[model samples]
Each structure stands twice: as C-alpha cells, then as structure tokens.
Target: MKNQTKWKISTLISLICLIIPFSIYSLWIYVFNLGTTQAERVSVFKDYFPDFLDGRWSTTIFSIIFSISAVILSSINLKHLKKIWKLINIIILILSGILLFLNLFSMM
Candidate 1:
C-alpha cells in the first residue's frame, strides 16, 4: 500500500482506539455517578466502588498509547492532512493523560 494509505488507515484505527474507550468510560462514569467533581465522585464511590474502576485507568492509558502511536504514524506520512491529524492526536493524548492523572490523584 502507499504511504498515504497506510497513514490514513493507521490514523483511523488509532483514532478509533482512542475514542471508543473514552466514550465507554464516559458512559460508565455517568452510570456510576463518577462524572462530576473529583471530590464528589470520590465521596460517592468511597462506600462501594467496583473493581472495574481500576481498569478504567488502564484503558485510558492504552488509549493514550494508541493516540501517541497514531501521531507517530501520521507524522511519517503527513503529506495531505498535515497539521490537523497531528494536532488532534496530540490534544487527545494530553487530555486523556490529564484525566487519568486527575482520577488517580483524586483518591488521595
């Protein structure tokens, strides 16, 4: 396949990998009352938080990794889209990392 085709495919896959989990996580947090302020969420979940919450952090990390990979792949063959894909992937990566960090530190 051509480099452009490879970049497009990898970018699409990585973008999906980044989005799908966060979508599911948002839904999960909504359902579990963890969508609001960190203090509020912590208070609510402190009594009976499920084991799966821990895994959500792992999922977010994986999503960040995928986004980073996509950025790298996109960087290699950025002949068409140029800055758009790279900017988007970078934003997603940073936001996901911030969210993960906040969630982890909120417990302390």
Candidate 2:
C-alpha cells in the first residue's frame, strides 16, 4: 500500500511537471494575443517569448503531445517497471520542470 501510494504521488508529480508548464505556456501566448491568427501568434511569441513556438507550429504540437503522453502514463501500468525506465522518467520530469520554469513566472 505504501509503495502504491508513493508511486501514485510520484506519478501525479510527473504529470503536473508536464501539464502545468505546457498549459501556462500555451495560455501565455493565447492570453497575450487574445485572438490572433497563427502567423500573428507566432510572431508575438517570437518577439517576446523567443523560442521554438515562433519557428514552427509542429514543434508546439510535438511538445504538447509528448507532455500529455507523459502525464497520462504516469499512473499507467506499473508492472513493467525497470531501472532504465525510471531514470528516463526522471529525465523527462526534469525536462518538463525546466520548460515550465523557463516559460512562466521565472524571470530568471
């Protein structure tokens, strides 16, 4: 039971690590733009946000998909646990955190 709870909490943390950043980022762009076209949104973020969001919508879509998948799989099947996978999960979580910190409320 303890293990399950720990794993569940860890998984939830991982999900938040992914979702919160992406949500804040997309919302940041949408909020600033309010109702702009694709090109306009890209231009604004490029000028202000200054990241891949400017170069390609494909990049945005890719990040969103991967982040969402990581969130979903956090609570998924635990039967296949392996050391390598755990390390990878940690890396993914850290990357998500970095993205989140970089995007919103960082100023750092």
Candidate 3:
C-alpha cells in the first residue's frame, strides 16, 4: 500500500513537471503571436517573463530540466501503474520526450 502510494505521488509529480513546459511553450506562442512588430512582441514577452529573454537561457534550461525529470519519473512508474495510470504515464513520457527534443534542438 505504501509503495503504491509513493508511485502515485511520483506519477502526479511527473505529470505536473510535464505540464510546466507545455504551458510555458503555449504561453510563449501566445506572446509571440501578439504585437505588430518583433521588438513590440519581445517587449511584451519580456514584460511578462523577463528571465526567459534575458539571454541566460532560463526557458530552455527549465524546459529541459522539467522534461527530463518527467521522463525519468514516468518511465520509472510506468510498469508499476495500473490501466488508466499506465496510459497517463505513457502519455507523460511521450510528451516529455518531445519537449526534451525540442529544447535540445533549439539549443543547437
């Protein structure tokens, strides 16, 4: 019982980690689509999430970290979870992989 509970908590944490990057990217796209000019769009985005645009690689770094952690957690819990949870964990794993790939590719 206790072990199963631990896996459940890990699964939830993994799902949350997976969500962070997707939400961030979605907001990024929304911000990117706003404004009439490049500078204007950047200024708007900077106004909201200045750390991401400060040249410190905050977005990329956080995305990669969260995605990787989600992937790890999900993979570890995949075999332990039952039906619906197994499905959710698989989805998390796949999305995390994609997020990790995009972040790594963007860095290159």
Candidate 4:
C-alpha cells in the first residue's frame, strides 16, 4: 500500500510537469493558429478559449514554464513543498482574479 502511494505521488509529479508544457503548446496553437488559417481555427478549437481573449500567447507561455518549474522544484524538495505550493497558488490566484476583474471592468 505504501509503495503504491509513493508511485502515485511520483506519477502525479510527472503528470504535472507535462501539463504545463502541454497547456502552453495548446495556447500557442490557439494564438498563432500555426499551420492553421482563421477559417480552420474555429472549426478546430474555439470552445476552449474565451471570445474576448486577445490571444496574448507570450504571457501565457512564460507563465506555463514558470509554473511547471516551480512544481518540479517543490516535488524535489518535499520539505518546503507546502510553502512553495502555497506561494505559487496565491500568485496565480491573485493574478487570474485581477485579470478577470479588469476584463469585466473593461466590458462595463
């Protein structure tokens, strides 16, 4: 049972690392529409993104890299993992909250 738990944790860490890169790639594909035209983009994937979004891919890509690195580091240094995760969560939560607020304000 204990070994299974450890394996689950290890798998989780790997999965988390992959998610960040995958999200960034998805966002990149959304913004650039690389190898895809406007008419094709909508047919391919329009439901995932907000209609209001201006496609700022650079910001999102950097954020993904930073987030993934933070998680990987925390996983390695389990002793400080809680503190690191808290900080990361707070930063992302506040940033997203501010973005959502500003967007709503702009629309109003």
Candidate of highest TM-score: 3
lDDT of 1 by residue, 1-108 (tens): 486566667667656655654664565476466446766664554334445545535544544455455445544434444567667656655654554454445435
Off by over 4 Å in 4: 34-108
**Please, what are the lDDT tens digits per residue for candidate 2 over residues 1-108?**
667667656666666557645764776666566546766655555565445555545345545555655644653523434465566566665666466345333332
The collision pairs in model 4 are none
User: If scored against the real structure, what TM-score would every candidate get?
Assistant: 0.46, 0.41, 0.87, 0.33
Off by over 4 Å in 3: 50-53
Model 1 regions more than 4 Å off: 33-81, 102-108
lDDT, residue 94, model 4: 47
lDDT score of residue 44 within candidate 3: 76
lDDT of 3 by residue, 1-108 (tens): 898889999999999999988987887789888888988876776676655446546777888999999999999999898988889899999999999999899788
C-alpha local distance difference test of each model: 0.54, 0.56, 0.87, 0.48
Global fold similarity of model 4 (TM-score): 0.33
Query: Which should have the higher TM-score, number 1 or number 4?
Result: 1
